[model samples]
Target: MAGLITCLSVPFLSYLGLRSLPAQETAPRTIVNLEVIVVDTESKALEALERLKKGEKFSTVAAQMSIDPNAGNGGYVGEAEVASLRPELRAAVESLQP
Candidate 1:
């Protein structure tokens, strides 16, 4: 009975160790960059921004005005982490107060 108990405890301890181990979570299906086509031509960036200001869905405006040739498929330019744009566009995007 003692030997059997120890054997049972070994598996239980193994289970506990595994359960406590950090779980590796894959990122939620990454929004593919291809999905956010930013048509950002000098002519078009503002048009899309205007639509966003008017409360249009950003994705919709992206679809319509993203200047990237693939805009029809995935109009994304990944992201523009605040400090990265040209001072003017950065000012414009940051000023949106979104």
Candidate 2:
């Protein structure tokens, strides 16, 4: 009876030890600051991209052309966790370097 009890207790103690161990490491969360220029059509979006590439100021173009309510603030979307963003936006933001 004592031998059987010792065997059972050994496995139970080992199980408890494993459960108390810390979890595996996880990657750090990413945070990003974002701005956007929303437009009514693909053509308009393309034009805005062109203007930005050609040196037009972001604030100037956003205020003049974006349809989003935040246009007044130069399309600033504020800081956010990258994981919380939509999938398409997350992929785009992740591709950028800090």
Structural similarity to truth (TM-score) of each candidate: 0.36, 0.67
For all candidates, the clash counts are 8, 0
Question: Taking the tens digit of each residue's C-alpha lDDT, what string does model 2 give over 59-94?
Answer: 888998999998999989799999999999999998
Candidate 2 residue runs with Cα over 4 Å from true position = 1-27
lDDT at residue 4 of model 1 (Cα atoms) = 46
Error of 2 at 81 (Å): 0.6
Question: Cα deviation in Å at residue 66, candidate 2?
Answer: 0.1
TM-score of 1: 0.36
- Superposition TM-score, candidate 2 onto the true structure: 0.67
Q: What pairs collide in candidate 1?
A: 36-75, 36-76, 37-74, 37-75, 37-76, 38-75, 39-66, 39-67
Largest lDDT belongs to which candidate? 2
Q: Alpha carbon lDDT of residue 23, candidate 1?
A: 33
